[model samples]
Target: MFDSIKLRKQHGYQAIRDIRTATVKAPFRGFPRLDGEKCDLSCLACTAVCPTGAIATEPLRIDLGRCTFCGECERGCGTGAIQFSSAHSLASTDRNDLIIQSGQTPESFRETAIQSRREIHRLFGRSLKLRQVSAAGCNGCEMELNAANNVNFDMGRFGIEFVASPRHADGIVITGPISRNMAPALKDAYLSISEPRIVVAVGTCAISGGIFADSAQLDRSFLDEVPVDLYIPGCPPHPLTIIGGLLDFRRHK
Candidate 1:
């Protein structure tokens, strides 16, 4: 009984230390604030809904990394203490370095992600330039790939301009199973791209035919058509992951 009490006290002390550490290392200091008098909002909803516990009272702040960029806090804030900025340098060598302060609202986070995609597109250049073919996919991967170019995920930022003709493309983005029916089309697409090209096999279906592993109709081989530069193995990888893979390709080139 005495040992149990001692262990409990030790855990309590550690918890207090953690809180203290977080307080001292808090990233947002002197972030801008609205004139509460000028704005007649009565509720502090941001404080209640922040998923990461990144927001604070006394003066409002946000740790960007802890934030999922989900915009929940901004939506919850009635006084508009939280906001988004187009600052996408949320990456860091140190994991803790991604914290940021915008003082904007949740609406801003959406704008920021959009703006970031735009910047990525601009940097990558605006040319309809890649051919994508799915061999034996469930369509989920294709939907996400399409969404990257849609208004929300906005894949055009990395200059992921899709092309209808393989001859006009710089690379091939493949998804789905390498079904026998699609094999000829996939091979043709790979062959049609110019030299110094790339192939990205997206989703587990394209990589290994996923659930269709034993199906005789599925080739179960991405390499049969062309040499793959990147393999994104997910049931259907997120749009951001697709973008990241493209960006990584750019870095290598």
Candidate 2:
């Protein structure tokens, strides 16, 4: 596949080398490397599901450029071998330099999300926090998101947290379809969050009502109830994507 001069010229030779190096070297690198702890390195779901066979078990490597980060491997792994990290510092000058996985546990990841939430709250000088509402969701999205606050994802890492009271929140995170029964509650919550604040729609359901589009009890659009600053599109996006969206908002503000 490397024979095309035009393609090679467009991407440069160094970029390709760096990508290969990252894939070969990544599996050997341990998590918490700074602490001298080694990853179990026992999980191989990424190898099995990699559409292009970019991941391999014998050498334990991943071709960065070829990786889709679809979280298929992470989700499929029963042992949590492949994981999402709060570390988003994967940018590189060379196209092939992106082969490493940060391997952050759900615990560390949540901690970072919480920390960001708190910082944003503090910046507003508000004692209140953010509220999360579920519309006509399959419960998978809600469960995954709620899981972040448990010991695993640890939403407290970023100082941002979820609150039970809408009045206390600076914004609202809505997940799933806007069920007819929940419409009033969703609207009330959106209105309760203080003004100059924002709303975030998570998952395909909240954005487009998703698979429940034909359900008589669900609304077609959630934006009708609240102004959304962000729309995360996924059946249930990985927790990292949700965190990334929030952090992006933080940076923009």
Best by the lDDT measure: 1
Model 2 — TM-score against the truth? 0.50
Candidate 1 wrongly placed segments (more than 4 Å): 1-128, 220-222
lDDT of 2 by residue, 1-253 (tens): 6768779687553322221122223322211111102223565655677554435544444443344345555556565545544333222212232234344333343333222344544454333256888876778779868765655345556666888888778888888778888887888778777776767777656765555656798754447544555555445665545555465445423
RMSD of each: 21.9, 19.3
Cα lDDT tens digits for candidate 1, 35-63: 33433334657657755465555444555
Best by TM-score: 2
| TM-scores for all predictions | 0.49, 0.50
Off by over 4 Å in 2: 1-128, 220-222
